[model samples]
Target: MDSRIKMENSMNMIFFGPVSSFMRIDAESLLHILTFTKKHLIPISRTILIWDLITDGKTAAFLYSREYLALGPLLNFVPEEDLYYVNFGDKSVLSFFANHNLGLHSRKYGILAASYRRYYGDMWYEDSDYINELGYLICGFPAHIISKITPAVFKKIDVEIFKKLSLCSVNQTKTLYNLATHKNAYGKPYKWSSHEITKLDILFICVPKESISSIRLEAIPAISKHIMEMIHQDKLEYFTKQQILRMNPEARRMYIIRVQLRTSLDTSQIAKQDANAIKKSVPLALIYVFTLILK
Candidate 1:
C-alpha cells in the first residue's frame, strides 16, 4: 500500500477516480487499495462505474464488497455475469443485495441469478421486486424461498407472472395471503379485507377455507371491473380445475361462473363463424360431386 494514497480526508471526492487511474498505471496498486480501503469511507451515491475494471472480480468483490455492492444496483455497474465471479455464500452479502433499492431493470437478471445460484436456506428477501422476479421464473425455485419475499410484490406483480407461479405450498400461499390482505407496508398485521382478497391473482386458487368462509358472497361481483380484467384473462396461468377446488365456496363459485361465461361467449362466436363457412362450402361441395359423377 502506498503512503500517498493514505489521505482519508478526501476519500469521498477524490478516492475512486484517482485510484482507478493509478490502478491502470500499476495494476497491483488497485488490489492494495481495495485491501486497505475503509469500508465506511466509500461514497455510495456517485455515478462512477469502476466495478467493470477489475479483471479479478472475485478477489476484488471479496475485499471491497462493503463499499462496491450498492454500485451494482445504483449504477447497474455489476452485471449478473460479473457477479458470477463473486461468492455470495455469506448471508449478509446476499441480504445486502436485497435490502438495497434495486436499479437492475429486470428482477430476473442479477437478483434471480444470485438466489438461483445458491441452495435454499438463509433465504428471505426485503425488496418486493425479488418476489416479482421469482414469480416469472421458467423453472422451479424452492417454495420455501417465498417465506420472506415482500408480499407487496403481489399487489403490483404482472398478473401474467402471478398466473405462471402456482408453486406455493399451502402454508406459503396462506402466508402470502395473510401478508397481502392483512398486513401493512412494514409487515405489521392489519385487518384482512375480503375485497383485498380478490387482488392476489393465482394465489386465489389456494385460499384457505377460513378465508373463503369470510368472503362476502353478495359483494364478490363488486370486486371491481378493472380487477376482474386483471384476473380473468383468456389465457390460464394456473390450473384452475383441481387447484381452485379448495378455494372458498363463494369465491370458487364466482370464478367458475365467470370462466364458464367467458368460454360460452368464445364458443358461440366460433360456432357462428363455422356455420357461415358450412353454407359457403355446401355449394362448392355439390359442384365438385356433380363434376366427379359426370367424369
Candidate 2:
C-alpha cells in the first residue's frame, strides 16, 4: 500500500475507529502520539485521551493546540502542574483564559504565569550565546514578570509584547496602555482617540464600565464572541450625555426620540421565558436575581 494510505489507515484506527485497540497508553506515550500527530489530533470526547492530558504535569504543553482550549473550565479543576505547559502566547489560548475569568488573583492563574516565566528562562540562551531578549517577547510573558524586567532589556521589547500579557490588573493595563500610547497620563484618562482604544482588546476588561464609545465600533473579532460583545457594546450604547446636550434643540429632540425607540427595542429583546421565570421566582424570593431565584 502507498504511504498516504498507510497513514490514513493508522489515523483511522488511532482516532476514528475504536481507540481501545491500541495497547494501554499512559501520559508519556500520549505526548509522543500528539507530537507525531501534530495538528492532526482530532478534538474528540474520548475520555481516555482527555484523562491522560489532564492527569500528567509535563504532558500539558505537549498537548497544546486550539482544540484543547475548550477545556478551560475543566482544566480549572485539574492539577495546576497539568496546565504548567500551556502556551499563553496564543490569542486563542488567552481568550480561553479570559472567558473563564483567569486573571489576577485567580488561584488557577498562578501555574500558567509560572509556566510562561519558567519556559522563558528555559528558552533563553546560555552565557556563551547571544541573548535574543527581543525574540523572547513572542512568548507572551506574564504581566508581573514584565513589570520586573530591567529597563535596558525592557526597552528592547516592543509595545505589542505588553499588549499580549497573560493577565493584567487595572493599574497594570492602564500603565501599559499609557506606555503603548505614549500618553503617560495619570489615573488613566478616558480621552484617548478611537484608534488607540481598539488596541486594548482583552485588556479592556480592566475598564469594563467605561463609556463604550471609547472603543471601536467593531470589537476585536479574533477572540470569542463573549469577549467581542463587551467591546462592541460600547458602539451599541447610546452616545454620551454631553454629546446629546450639545445638540441643537431640534436635534436633541430627535435624539431623545431615537433613544426612546432604542429603549423599546432593547426591552423587546428580553426573552419572555426569562420574565416568566422571574415571575415564578418572585413569589418565592421577592424578585431578587438568580441567587434568590435559583432553581
Candidate 3:
C-alpha cells in the first residue's frame, strides 16, 4: 500500500476505535508509537489523539504513572483548565494523592482540591470544586492555599467573574491581573484570591502569547524574562530593540523549541540564502512529530 494510504488507515483506527485498546500503553511509549507509525499527522489530529488518551480513565492512569502529561508532549494542544477537571474526576482522596505524587506538575485545580481535602476531609468539597473551576479563569493563583479560609471567602467569589475568566471573554485575565495586583481605594492590598503562587507560576510559564491575543501585552513580562536571559547568557543571538519587538512571536517559538530540543541550534549560523528554506522546513518536521504518530 502507498505510505499515505497506510497513514490514513492508522489514523482512522485511532479516531474510530475504542481507547481501551491503548490503555496499558505508557506516555513515552505511546508518543514514540504514534510518531513512528505515520510520522506526519496534522496538529488537530495530534490534539485529538492526546485528548482521547487523557480523558480515558485507564489510559490516563497509565500515562499519569509515567508523569508525561505536563512534559510539553501535549503543550499548547490541551486547554490547561479542562485537563485538571478531566484528570481529577471524582476519585477518592487516596487515589487523587497517588496520582499527584507521580510528579505531574500542572493542573492547579487538581492540586488545590486534593490539598483541601487532605486537610479538611471534604467538609467543603463543593466549595473547593467551585474554586478550582474558578481558578481556571484567572491568570494567577487559582485559590489561595490557605490553611484556614473563612466561609465568607467562598461567598465573596463571584461566579459570573469566574465564567468570564474561564471562557476568556474579552480581556478578562488582563483586567483581573491588573486589579488583583493593585491596591484598593484605601491604599491597602486588595486580596483577590489565595496566597499560593504555584498555579500562577505555571501559568506565566506555559501560556503562549502569540496564540492567545487577549494576554499578549500581559504575557510580555513572562516571555521577555526567558528570552532576555537567553540572550544575556549567549544562547540566542542579540537583536536591536525594534527587531526584538517584531520578533516576539518567533522568539517565543524558538524558546519552546529550545526547551523541547535542549540543544543549541543557533539561527545565526544558518546562511541568509538558506534561512527561508530552514524556516519552512521546521513546520514540516514538527507536523510529523506532532500529528502522524502510530497507535
Candidate 4:
C-alpha cells in the first residue's frame, strides 16, 4: 500500500503491523503532517519505548542463551542509557545486541550468524589476545557488567559516542531522541481499561483511517446507550447469559437462561432503582472508551 495515501486519510497509521518489520514516521514528520492536515490530531501523551530494540546483557542472554553466554560479559558493560540517543548508522549497534539473542535460537540461525560475522568481522574476538592491554575492552559490555570488568579494559574501548549521546547533545540530531528516553519530558504512562485497550487496537491498528473518526464517535455512544437501555429495561440478565454462552458453549444447559437473566436483572434493577448509579457508570465507561479510541 502507498504510505502517502494512508497518511493522508489518517494522521495515525502504523507503517508495519505489530510483530512485523516496520519503520514509522518519526515525531518530526508526524508534526509536519499534522500541521499540513490541519486536523486537531490527538497528541500521543505516552512515550513508546521500543524495548524490543534495546540490547544489554539481560536482553542478549534472553535471546541467544549460549552465544550471549560468550558475548554477554562484554556487552554488559555498554551503558544502555548512552546508546538511547546516538545514531549509529542505518542499523544501530545497540539493535545488533538486542536482536542477536533472537537469532541464536532462531530457525534461521545460520543466516543470522553469517550476517553478524560479516558485519562485525573478526575484530570482536581480538579482545581474547589483548586481554592485558585492553582490560578496558570488557567494559564494552552492558551497564550491569561494567562493575565486573577490569578498569583498564574499560579505558581502551572507544565509548566516545556513548558518552556524547548520554549528555543529551549531538550535532544536528536535535532532541528527537527524547521519544525513546526522557520519561517526564516526552511520554507519560497510560493505564488503560480493557475496553479502552480493545478500542485503541481496533481504531489505530486494524481499521482504515477514513472510518476511524466516525466509528470511534459512534462506538462510544452506541455502547453507552446499549448498556444503559439494557439496565433500565431489565434485559441485562438475558444479555449477560448470551455473552456467557458465546464465550463458553460447554456451560450447563439447565442454568444457562437462568444465569443470563440473573446477570441482566442485576444490572437492569440497579439502573431502575438508582438514577445516580446509571449516571455515574455510563459516563465513565464512555470516557474510558473514547480516550483509547482517540489515542
Candidate 5:
C-alpha cells in the first residue's frame, strides 16, 4: 500500500536477476500494474513472476492464458473496453491453466478443462479423465448400468475412451451409451469394443452413480471422479458435510436420486415388513415406476 513499495514493485523488471529474488515478493503492486499494462507492454516473465508470488490462486490464475483468465475475475488493470489477446491453445499455456485452480466461478472453466484433457490424456479419475466425460455420460447413460461398476470389476475398456469422453458431444456420448446399454439389456455382459463402446459407455461402467448430473452437464465427470474416490474408501458419510451438500443443485439432485435408488434396492432385499420404510424414504410414485421398470 506504501508509495515506495508500489514503485518498487513496478520497477521489478529493472532488477534483472534470477526470478527467485522477486518470486517471494507480494504481488499486489504487480496486480496494480496489470491495470495500466498495455497488451504490448505486458511482460510474460513478469506475469509469471506475479503468478508465482501471489499465494491466493485466483489472482495468480489471471496471469497466463490472459483472455480466458480475465473473463471471470474483476481486475482493476484489465479494462473491459480493451481487448486482451493471448493464445490459449499453446501447449505451455494449456499446461499452466490445467495445473492451477482458477476459482470455479469462471464460465469458461469447463471448456478450458476439457481442452486440457484433449491436449494431455491424464485421467482425472481412474475410469474417466475429464469432468465433461461424466457430464455427458449422466445425461446419456442409464443409471442402473452406472451403479454396477466397481473398481474390482474386470471389464476391459478401450484406451481411447478417456480422450473420447473428454472431447465428445452429448449426442455422440448418448449414441455410444445406447449401443452398450442395448447390448447389456440382452441379459449378458456387453462385450467391450473400442470401436463400438464409446467413452460414455466406459464412464457409465466406471464413474460412481452418486456423481452424475450437472447444470452444464459437461462438468459432472470431474465432480464424479472426485466423489468416486471418497466412495471407494467407504466414505459414504462424506456427502453429509456442508461443503458436499452445497454443490450445484442439479448434481445434488442426481446424487440424491442415486442414493434413493440404492436405498430402494436395499429395501427390496429385506423382508416384506421393511417395504413400508422404502415408501417413506423415496416418493412412492417414483419408486413404483422404477420398481416396475428396473426390476
Candidate 6:
C-alpha cells in the first residue's frame, strides 16, 4: 500500500508531548485518568493506553508495574502482558502503531490497509501535566500490534518466504495451509526455537511497508536462506547463536512444528532445505521429513 494509506490505517492517536514529558505522572494518577476516561468521555469501541516514558527507565518501570495491571484489562485494545515491555522511544512507538493497525485489520477485519504512519512534531509534548489526560483521549482506539525487527535480522530472511509468512493473519484452524506448503516446498517441516518464535513475532509485528514491499521485490531467496538456517539451528530455544548449535534437532523440530501449526505459515525455506540436504547425513532429518510428508 501507499504511505498515506498505511499511515491512515495505523493506530489512530495524537501524542501531546515528548516521550520524557510523561515521567512526572505516577502510576496511580495515570490509572485514575484512564479509568475516568473509560467511564465517561472517549467514545470508541476499545481503548489502549500506553505510557511513553522514553529514557526515564526508573519511572517507566514503576508505572508499568503499578498502573499496567490496574488499567490493562479494562481496555479492550490492550496488548498482551507478555508483549508489554517495549520501549517508548520514537521508533518503538511507531512500531506499536503499526502493530496495532495490523492486529485490528488482519485478525479483526480480514482486510488490511496498505500503509500506516505516526504524526508528531517537536511541540507534540507541550502539555506535560496532562499527558495522562491525553492518553485517556487516545485510549481504546483499535490498533494493530507492531514489533521492531533489527536490520541484521531483516537481512537474514528470504523475500518470498517473508511474503508467505507476511500473508497477514492466516486462519489458525486451517490444518494444511500456506505455512505447511512452504515446509513441504523445501522438502521438510520447518522448525523454530522459542526465542526464534519470539523474534519472528517481533518481525511480523513491526515490519515496515517499505521493508515488506522491498523484501517482496528483492530479497525472497535470501530471506528463505536465513529462515532455513534459523529453523535448522532452532534459533528459538536460545537467544544466542551458541546455544542454538547445542540444541537437540528433535526438540527443535518439534518446536518448529508447533509454531508452524499455530501461526499457520511456513516461515523458513532454509530450514527445509537443510533438512533435505542432511537427510542422508542425519537420522533426525530423515524423521522430520518423514513426519512432515505423512502430515
User: Which candidate wins on TM-score?
Assistant: 2
Better of 1 and 6 by TM-score: 1
Ranking by TM-score: 2, 1, 5, 3, 6, 4
Name the lDDT value of residue 212 in candidate 4.
Answer: 26
Candidate 3 lDDT trough over 10 residues, lowest sum: 185-194
Sorted by lDDT (best first), the order is 1, 2, 5, 3, 6, 4
Which residue pairs collide in model 1, if any? none
Query: Which tens-of-lDDT digit does each residue in 1-295 have in candidate 4?
Result: 6987766656444322342322354434433433354322332221112222333223322333332333332332333443233222224343443333321222222233233434444344344233222222222332322223333332333322222222121211122222211343222112222343232221112222232223332122223221232222232222332232332223223223333333333554675766766556545433432343344
Reference-based TM-score of each model = 0.31, 0.37, 0.26, 0.17, 0.27, 0.22
Q: After superposition, how far is residue 212 of candidate 2 from its true place, in Å?
A: 11
Deviation in Å, model 6, residue 234 alpha carbon: 22
lDDT of 1 at 174: 57
Worst 10 residues of 5 by lDDT: 78-87
Candidate 2 per-residue lDDT over residues 13-108, each given as its tens digit: 765666666435665555455445633245445534554654442456555444354443444455556667666566455445434432224445
| lDDT minimum window of 10 residues, candidate 4 | 164-173
What TM-score would candidate 6 get against the native? 0.22
Better of 3 and 4 by TM-score: 3
- Model 6: how far residue 98 lies from native, Å: 5.6
Model 5 lDDT tens row, 1-295: 6997876665655334467656655556544445444433435555444444443434323345444343223322332222122223464464434443433323344344433444434333335333323332222233343344433221344333444343344454444444444534311223332233233333443323343221122333234432333233222323433423444555454555554554454543555546576557557535543443344
Over 1-295, each residue of candidate 1 has an lDDT whose tens digit, in order, gives: 4655566643544455565443353334443555564544454432233453444434434533464443444335445554444445665554544344333444333344454456333443554444444443312344455455555644555444445444334565555555555344322212334444444454554444444444444434434333333353443223233334344555444555555454343445557666766456445533432343344
Q: Candidate 3 on 84-162: residue-level lDDT in tens? A: 3333343442243323322223344354445434443554423645444433323223333331334444334443333
Scored by Cα lDDT, where does model 2 land? 0.43
Global local distance difference test of model 5 = 0.40
CA RMSD of all predictions:
16.8, 12.5, 15.8, 23.4, 16.0, 19.3
Best by lDDT: 1
Residue-pair clashes per candidate, as listed? 0, 1, 7, 24, 4, 45
